[model samples]
Target: MNVLFLGKIQYALYRLVLAETPEAYLLQTHTLPSDLNFMPTLGNGHLGYTVFGDAIFMNGVYNGAGGNSKRARIPNWLNISAVVCDRFGCATDDDELSTTNDTLYEMDLRDGYFRYRKDYKKLGITLEQRSYPHKYFNRALVYEVVASRHATTARSNAPQFLKLSQHPGIASDAFEFVVLNNGSNAKGDYRVIRGRTQVLEFERFQPQPHEIYILFSQSLEEPLQIEWPTWQMEITHRIIICIDREQSVALKDLQDALELNFQDLHQKHIKRWHDFWDNDFSIRIAGNSLELWQIANAGIFYLASSLPSLTTNQKNEPFDGLSPTGLGRGNLEADYQGHSFWDTEIWMLPVVTQFGYDYAKEVLEYRSRKLEAAKYNAYAKGYKGARYPWESAYTGTEVTNPCCPEVAQQEIHISADISFALQKFFAQSADFDWTCDKAWPIAAEVAEFLVSRAACEELKQVCHFLNVMGPDEDHANVDDNVYTNAMAKIALEFAVWAGGMCGNASTELFEKWQQVSNRLLILRDVDLDYHPQHEGYKLNTEVKQADTILLGYPLRFDKSSTHLNDLKYYANATRESGPAMTWSMFAANYLRTSEDWRADEYFERGYKSYVRPEFKVWSETPIGYEGSANFLTGIGGFLQALIFGYGGLDFYRSGNQTTMENSGVLMPPNVEEVEINYIRYGDSKCRWIYKSHSSFMDCGYRKSGKKFEMLQGNKRTLLATNFNVTHRKGDPPIYINLMN
Candidate 1:
């Protein structure tokens, strides 16, 4: 029950206890009651739900209508079950209740809701249930039930019933159920819907030409009796399923979400979950590791309920975004068809561009609406610009997995990782006319497909990149793969520095991007001095992750002792079942070499083995079963090991000054202190904090005349408008050891 806000904490309410059968509650559950693979999910991001104990399931809307067949583009189902009856018929089911004795099972992550309870005691009855998924009626889904009896063990001619069932998926066949009596009732009580009232309606039909419409309504009114043996009843079910390929507009949006008003749509779904946890960007760490502050506040609410905003398909297009099992519903024989990868522009758009810069500009506007299907997949492979697709979906072509054709034809650094996430979203939203009308023409067609897919060897003038696949999918078609030649030399020097900041500079494409960023090959081994996760990768030291310590942290491109000799030679050559963002990129390259106790022992061994145990949720290997479970690239590499590793925070752009550096905070010898508090940077919100030897920061700019500077460890400070600085360890050093 913790759940606090300004005074921190933010989430809690677990409480479990179910073992009364189903194979002793499926051997004390850890998922597998017919697997929704480690269940417990609820999403507002284009509808999602899982909860199994007494059924909930549901997952539609992304590519909605039986999704245009590739075996109906996955994500189906919309179950929702409930039942409890009596009249000497004694019935009770919510997966046959039994938290051993007086049943209970919760999961409330503060108001996202889900509860269940039971207590019979020789029929003196008691039941309680709650559910949610109507964050502001986006096609509604609410449930509430309550029953109590006990007037000295009530039995005065018992009569009770509360049944609700809607199945809608597995490619439906047909269905409909209704009970609506309109006697001018709008909660004028009339014994709540008149005479034990019941008004349920269902509709289903599937075949890619999909449709679903459930609409159930209740609050007691139809033949639901209990002749006062000390009664107390309360019901509230406002189902509404909807889906659509137009079955009469999915039965008029399930009768306008069962005629609204469930306490004003549950107070506008609790003020849209309190404006989604009070306007995003939040983190609070004080120390004694409560499992690293509940895995960094449940990895920012499972990446904001698994990537919300942006939904359209069945022809209205717009998808190519959230995947890695986001819109949930998987398993019809290993499905992940809900595509988009290169792990969403390099590990979930840098932790969703720090709390949504308009959801990281709708994931670069879904890669500028799939840049003309990535320029016709580089003009049917003749190549020369826009080749983005190591598994896109809803039409950005290359839907991979045709039995992994070398990651769909040699993972050509996913078009330079979508031109380095559109040059780090125009260098963190400086937004020069939307990076010259949408990301510098897709970063000049991804530097013209990495200069026509590299290779130009005119006798060692160098520019190889050969047979690629670097973000370690375990050495496939390798050669010169130092994190794909340092992200194709930072996407050809950020397409000649974003084509000279949008004036569209191109002196012969800036000398073919300075001869492919100075002969791009990058392999280096000089007798294990380091850097060689490619080009015969030093005869296999193995590594299926952090390809060369990601060139000294998110391609800072090598520094000091060659970034600590390739971060201690690939952090012991990776693979401890690699993936979970490989020890969060070896805890952000061991906190960029300050090595804070080896970055707090690989960030507590990558958060106690890739999260998911008592459900802190992360999963993408490390014994949490095959991929996806709120794994937005291992929660954006554990929020880049706590805001760029122990809050050292970075953020570039030097010439027209934007800086922000920090390089002070480290605290990892069993963390005695740490605080990030907030991090939005760029349209600022910064914050920092640390302790041992002092530190402080605020950066500020929740919208004002934006200007910044603050360096730290080597003194800078500048801030132009909103500020709050403080340094300490003899002040005059606010960040300039630039990885010396």
Candidate 2:
């Protein structure tokens, strides 16, 4: 869904009112005329006023009162009024409580066209407007009230009831009133009447016989005194007000700021939105509609603007997309709280990463810094090592509140997913050092936790990990959560490899890791040639649909590749599964050694039909859409399916025992294209063969004292960028038969 924003004009009013620290409440009364023909609801073809505030300041935009609040409202003549109040509503006489601060802000915003002009006059403020087609609204007069506060003696010595300060510390405050309307129209006349006296009047200006005239009034400002400390008390209150309008401010010793005439700022906002959409490079799709794209683009833009930059303090930021000012208010307090849950990492990060890798790295670093906390949290629960918080906030503490007090606490192994995410980031960016350092330790800790959690039935040669929740929030705290167990196994294996690669790892660490791996379990049904999600999965007739897609995602077992033929069986069983289940099936179909047409069929159904229409790719789908619709996990899997599934990039252990070879069991060698760049770490040595549909081409390059071979098909040429040719170390040089 497009990020719904509270209407712009109303939001502007709220910001203007809350501009100062001295909190204020703004209220207005609309009198239904006895004639019932006058003062129609302001928004609908009549007049209405709006209040905008920021921190401690407030402003208002005026429209003739006529439109209905419920139905529809778009005024022909627009003006603005403002006030700075103490609470939400508190005004007085002597210092006149009935008066309203007003400004004549004239504008017409319709059909992407707007024109606003204001002039300051002694009698009142005059406004003029002309829209895009040169459609002129002529002129209007608004009698406005000017409120000003002169010097006060309250600062002399604890004096309370003197004239109040305007900005408290600053000089006096001033308010200007103006009358606005069409010079000749009478149907739109209005007045701010306190009892029997009219405080302000709006008069319309026009030239023709058939012209219209509208009238409204402005309130004058009165000086009032507020309680203030006579002298210094080693204290200060700093208020930073962000305004919708652009105005200049002068702060004495303390800081005071203002933004007035902000029409240009609005233009800048729209321009930024446009720039983002312009830069979005999507491969041309066959049947794509511009309207659909606009909706998707707007949603993406809204998501980015609402979410904060991925810096440390800014993680898990939320914006009240549905509120005015689009600020984090209400439940939108999810902003600034830094609750970096799976939503940020799994659902949102892939999009951010595609746009900016640095942002993605910041999120990765945020998670890394929290690793120690995860470990301690796990230990607190009596788990052997780290168990990531199901919901992590700024403190890195588990925010996963259990279903009830009786349960004490919910099992949290989602940290396994966190480790999985780290691995994926490294694989995508080729950041080996990060993987070797930060990721390895945490992965190792999680593996340790899993080892303690795993149980074995030695007679049956079965191992099983249990007591965790899967992505499907509908079910919780179950055994062998396929998602969790698969991730744990992968985390364990990778951690072991990482530790061993360090060479100087302690024997204690290695032995502990071995114990964890040996206890790791996989439940298999030899007759069916497939694995179950968990021990009780078969007994859970209601949950029978969970095994296939849920089991398919982890790709934990080596034999999953051999189980692709059983998909139709799984699909037939899960025919009634929901979209979340369906999306998982699509991913599994893509990952396994399945037929291209069958995989594509599932992919289309899941992506185009099952998931939200708003989710066009792996990037836009949030976790709410799928169980674990996460950062790059799904996207990475999607990419892997494209490359490894269709391209068949599998590397199997060779019979020679010293090397791995492309099995060529899936995709045939002579088909499309394979171009790769390799970066070697440490003393590892390997050879790559690039084969094309036509003929084989071969070459090599050197960089930073390291050599890499470049192999191309005979029909294709090696197009190198920023590289120099070189020979592979200790390899037999071979000649290429070029067409030339």
Q: Considering every candidate listed, which one attains the maximal lDDT?
A: 1
What C-alpha lDDT, on a 0 to 100 scale, does residue 113 get in candidate 2?
20
lDDT by residue for model 1 over 213-235, one digit each (tens)?
Answer: 33334323233333322243333
Predicted model with the maximum TM-score: 2
Q: Report the lDDT tens digits of candidate 2 across residue range 586-685.
A: 5445545435456655544434432222222122233333221112223333333433443333321111111111223122222233322221211221
Q: Which runs of model 2 end up more than 4 angstroms from their true locations?
A: 1-352, 402-412, 456-463, 472-478, 502-504, 539-562, 569-588, 604-740
For each candidate, give its TM-score against the true structure.
0.35, 0.49
Cα-based lDDT at residue 71, candidate 1 = 19
